[model samples]
Target: MDFFNSALGKNITFVRPEYFIITGFVGIPNMKYYYIFLFFVYFVSVLGNGAVMALIFLDHNLRTPKYIAVFNLAFVDLLGNTVLVPKVLDIFLFNHPFISYNDCLTFLFFCYTCLCMQSLNLVALSYDRLIAIIFPLHYQVKVTHRSMLTLIASFWAFVVTVNLIIAGLLTRLSFCKSVVINSYFCDHGQIYRLACNDNTPNLVFGRFLIFLILWLPMVFIFLSYSYIVYTLSKIATFHERVKAFKTCTAHLSLVAIYFIPIVITFTMSANIHPNARIINLSLTSIFPPMLNPIIYVLQTQEIKVSLRKILKTRMQTKVMAKKVIIM
Candidate 1:
């Protein structure tokens, strides 16, 4: 905790207006309490995505390729938020906002890993939907449980490797300040800017990796969804078309959340006009997770139904316990 107790730790640095200023500007402006608003969003995210995960784990009926993909999406969301939100609450509540340099780097590594994994998971999910839609004949045979398990394992392995490489590269650099990160969590771009050495390689490699993780998958997803829509158009009946669309609805909403902000931020993070920088970075930090669960709940019927079921089960269990005590 030497780093935490250091002089650098006590002083807060907002690290460019890019972090919090625009969040105040465009994000729910009428609300007097921004942290409270974020708390509500975090709570709903946990409850909604946690319920989605529980349904996927507990209900055997929902264990199909489509739902398995949804489960993976929920897993990514849960892990990412768990890392990000609690630290934010700690900062807001206790003024114990200091993260040790090592801890900051570690958090930055995992945040990048989880973010990448979230994108990879979405690509996997969308691909599952694409196969189920375009090539229905081989859907089961192609996306078998064993194959999916292998895919998930491979995805994690690849992501961990990427994180290791990036972290190894970053370790060679020096950090001189404990400047409090402007954003709630230790995001990579902010931390990288603090490195004392020449970060040109880091910048180049980071962007390349981002392209692979985000934009490349985006291109593949666009192609897959395009064909999926094309195939759906061939269906004669409107009900069948709607059913097909319904199957992909949740995945589509997820893709929108996973890609939109990253594309916006990555495109503009470097050499942007002073006026627009704040707005661009805030899109990455504040927007996606805030709306993620709302999109999930609204897009996925199973999540809604499962949330109701979980709530009802808890209520019934409580009532039965009360009756037992009465007796």
Candidate 2:
């Protein structure tokens, strides 16, 4: 209380509650089944993303600028879902929807940070593809391991700082109106709207975040692909053009999976029921992390090759151990 008062202004009095009730899935029919589905999705997401991260760590061939972005994407997806799903289950599934004020702010910080990073990681991957496709000859020079690492590190710094500001701003608002948050998680928008005092700062920043996290990244990706398409048009052979486009299929699929649902949900929000909107938003959050690794494994030849190589090596080691035991 003193901290928030000090941080905001000495004259201002903040009316914060001990806890806030989450009512995101309340009144929805058969919500237990939805929680069960989330459990399944979380399980698969852990396995798939873990496998991708493990493969990247174990294989030297994946130690390139491209896989650096891929590794970061997998990491963000794993973390984003990890921060979101378990708490969601605890709150709704286990019948514990009351989160303390400080805990809720912390939850908002980590979830929003990871969420922002997921989109920016996609931007990193898009940048990798843009350079690889557009400037094949200078790809290595332009997209170095050091450079990619720096770019990813910069993204982390930026996203973490932004979300910290968001969380900090939330501390200033006095939630005298209501303490029940209306989203699946401790969503920033939901929390701010509950404030009795002026939330213009929060509201303005929220809009800025929408542009920064969603629309800006989407625009960058779209432009990157457009450039890639333009560059591919210059290629003389149809086979080469097809091959080049094929390299992008996995990334394209990931972009679609990550953005399209979000776009639809937000655009159609007015027409959609609140319960339906909650379910759609939840699915949008959980689905990409589960699907990203699968799409990469199936579409990206390099990941497939790495998986087979690792499996073959493990099998050969087992066979050799059996031979030694027999002798």
Candidate 3:
């Protein structure tokens, strides 16, 4: 309160609430099943993303610009799930929906930050692919380790700054109305609407956020792929073009998994039932992290080869240990 008063000026007094009740899944029937499903998703997400990160870290062969982006994606996925799932389960499954005002804002910050980063990460991968396919002759010079790290670092700085501004704006709002957030997490839209004071800043920023995080990234990816197709068309041989296009399959799958559900949910928000909308949005957040590593492992040849090599080495080491014990 003191900080708000001091920062917002003495003329404006903000009414802050102690806690907010999350009623995201309150009316849904048989939500226990959904909780079980969330638990399974979280478990797989942790394991899969962890393995991907570990593989990228341990295998020197995977220390390329593309795998740098892959490693970042895996890290974001692991972080995003860890921040979201268990809290959701506690809120809905355990029937504890109360979240402190500061805590709620922190939740919103992390969730939105990770979600935004996921989109930007895809954009990074798209850039990686676009460069690889369109400008293969200069790929090594253009997409070096320093350049990739710099790109990812710039993205982190931008996203974190935007989300901090978001949380800071939320702090100025007076929540004199209902303290019940309809979403599973501390959604920015829901929280802003609950404010009794003028939330015009939040409202305007919310729209800007949608564009920056979702629409802009989607447009970039679309144009990148379009250019990639154009470049591939100029290749002399059919097999060569096919071989070039195949590299993008894993990234394309990830883009679809991440963006498609979000597009559908936002497009149909008015027409869809509230419960259905919530379910869709929740799934959109949770599913991608779990599926991303799986998609890479299955689709990308390098990851598969590296995984096999690591496994074989471990197996040989185990056999050697057993022989020594027997001797």
Candidate 4:
């Protein structure tokens, strides 16, 4: 039993593979490019999400179920991206590659919780649009702020529970053999590969979780949009249809971003080379959060108007201040 023994004072336990190497884009020449790219992603994700959140907070007119979903998704984007992207920068810039087992587990816990929140929040957003499209007259009563807040709370509850379950199961496994994770960050599959004993239970559990976490939500989203299309078809006016289509495009794009990657990445997992997979995984973490605010908030008409108004007011105030100073 060759456990990777470590003596870290009193808080010690029987652990193997004391630490794992995070080889995120290693051997790529001029590593500053990766750092720049990650920084851009993290910065934009935070800025975009934060801007939208502040706008939503200040603009009471935009406080509806749909915008609430946007706000929640933005929060999730800021959260998950912050958790993982900074670590990526640390690895590349600070030359810190070793992730202790406990730290890795903790990171995985928070990271996946955010992901689950994102998936379910998108589902909630789709449902909001569904009600708006299908039952426009009833939308005010059907999707109240209270209802939306409850839904958001329930989403947090469900995601935190599921993530805890997955993390608990993972922590139960013994890793006595290989510990070399061949990719960037603490990927679940890459880490699970290090286990010496049969990992079928973990693998099966992970697959089942995918079905619950992603597949179910994807199906629900598709179903909701399916009904939305049918309802939209009943509308006699072309302008109404166009308006509806525009509203849905943002969410559908988010859906594509969220679901398609999982399918493609998993399908390609078998035959694709490691480096390619590494890039795929890294981008998956980066793209959704980075793009969500652009699609859902900034591109929307109301948010744009609100932003312009706020900026124009600030400019007017500045000019008035200059006149006062001149006097």
Candidate 5:
């Protein structure tokens, strides 16, 4: 807030949310235990995603369109969680939820960016799988690294433009004296609801975005998988069918893990404690990023092989050092 005070005193004061109190997870009992659990989650998420990215980065064999998308997803997972977890933890532990308006918007921007990035990357991954399965011979030509990168760049531009429009509307809202964001972070809906002026525009647009962001990517994914299933049906051999199913196992698990809680939590939040619900929503947000790499590690033999190679190299290096010491 002080930094904002120093930076934008008179020039930039057009209906700003000065300070907001974050009020999710703070109401929970045993603050210490919650902190510990969150720390564990944060550590695991970083490690798991970082390891996957490292494997993809270092090994040329893993550098395909599929793994490239995986790398991007892992990156956003780490990014999204890092932005919120540490800050939210600070709020939870120290009772310091009062955040500057600028900072809140910053957090919101990154949150939406990460969400869109993950969703789009998943859609890309699904398309890659779809093409590979549906057009085995021409898949290589269709889904090249250069082509996927172009799609990624386009996706980045689109999501940023959309989110910027949302944020632009958010800045236009008028707030009352009591400017407190009642969530783990500055939720877009919560802040909009606090506006003193007519917020129907905000509400309508927000709802539309929810439908757009959630449903459209999922529809594409479903269509791709439906095509894959149709293609699989033409295959006669049982072993071949099993192999094809194995390829989709990781992605299907990740999609289920991500989507189920979103459907359950948002729809059912009204029936439960609002703070509890927001906390649960927060959990859902971070949990997928954490779980994604774990799912890959468990389901993907290539990833396991990479892990084994990494471990073996480290062990051999250690052995060489020990032998030197003995000499």
Candidate 6:
């Protein structure tokens, strides 16, 4: 452990195995290409999610509960990308990657918050979909604007409280071990492994938390969707049912894209070659942000039309003002 504090340790600031994928790609023969690719991907993800969030907020016609849920999903995705992507981009720029203890804690907090928010968003969206499709008549009354806002507010508050509890528990523990985290971001699960104190409490509590936050919602999502399908079968209008199913396609796509990688990454972190942590994380984090916004924009016709309408209206307004000024 003293080696970590030595000049040698200072030179090798990153706490990862030499064989880590990031080490190979970032350290490799042609490092320029890797950095360029990383920058490009991050840029695309940021712009894409940012645009989706903006589009949803800007388009007044998209103020319904369905699109509102999509907007919230975009917001969570953007936040998740922000918490992880900039630090990852910085790592690409610097050689001696040393994040201070406080920085580590901060990163862990943001990462946890973003992830929990995303999971909660999915849960909320699942319920939203179940209601919209399964109980269309009641959706207006049950998922009223006020009700949606309340749900969103509660989801964010609950997630924050959960994160605070975990972070508070983490702060009391000291890290006497080497601080080399194998992954790009400071995931709580990964960070706990580096702590010197007894983590049995942390592990038990964390796993219980993991079960509550991750698996429970997933179960609900599945059950809700199952009941939704059953209800859809009872609807007589084939065309109406088809249209509702189309609406679900976007949400289902997002769920699959997000959950598959998350489950894979979690499994890898639990019991696989630690060297692949970066790959697993990139798959889970990097790719989803880029794809989620694209998925929503492409799948939803209303958003595209509304965006075009807004752009046209702005252009026409500018033209009219210019003509008046010239006169």
Where model 4 places Cα greater than 4 Å from the true spot, the runs are 1-17, 28-31
Off by over 4 Å in 6: 1-34, 268-272, 318-327
| Model 5 alpha-carbon drift over 4 Å, by segment | 1-15, 324-327
lDDT values, one for every candidate: 0.69, 0.93, 0.94, 0.82, 0.83, 0.73
Predicted candidate 6 versus true structure: per-residue lDDT over 28-63, tens digit per residue: 355566556667767887888888878878887888
How do the candidates rank by lDDT, highest first? 3, 2, 5, 4, 6, 1
Best by lDDT: 3
Q: Which 10 residues in a row give candidate 1 its minimum summed lDDT?
A: 15-24
For every candidate in turn, the CA RMSD to the true structure comes to: 7.1, 2.3, 2.3, 4.3, 4.7, 6.2
Q: What lDDT score goes with residue 192 in model 6?
A: 68
Model 2 stretches astray by more than 4 angstroms: 1-13
lDDT of 5 by residue, 1-327 (tens): 444333334444335656778876665677678677878899999999999999999878899988888898899899989987898888878778788888888888888888878888888888888888888899889999999888888888988988887787777676754587777888888888887666687798888887777788888888889988888989999899889878999998888887778878878977998867876887888889999999999999999998899889999999999999999
**Candidate 2: residue 315 Cα off by (Å):** 0.7
**All candidates: TM-score:** 0.77, 0.96, 0.96, 0.91, 0.91, 0.84
Question: After best superposition, candidate 5 residue 175: deviation in angstroms?
Answer: 0.5
Better of 1 and 4 by lDDT: 4
Residue 87 in model 3: lDDT: 99
Tens-digit lDDT track for model 1 on 229-251?
88888999999999889978777
lDDT of 2 by residue, 1-327 (tens): 776566446666778789999999988889999899999999999999999999999999998889999999999999999999999999999989999999999999999998899899999989988989988999999999999999999999999999999999988888766899989999998999988677899999999999999999999999999999999999999999999999999999999999999999999999989889988988998999999999999999999999999999999999999999999
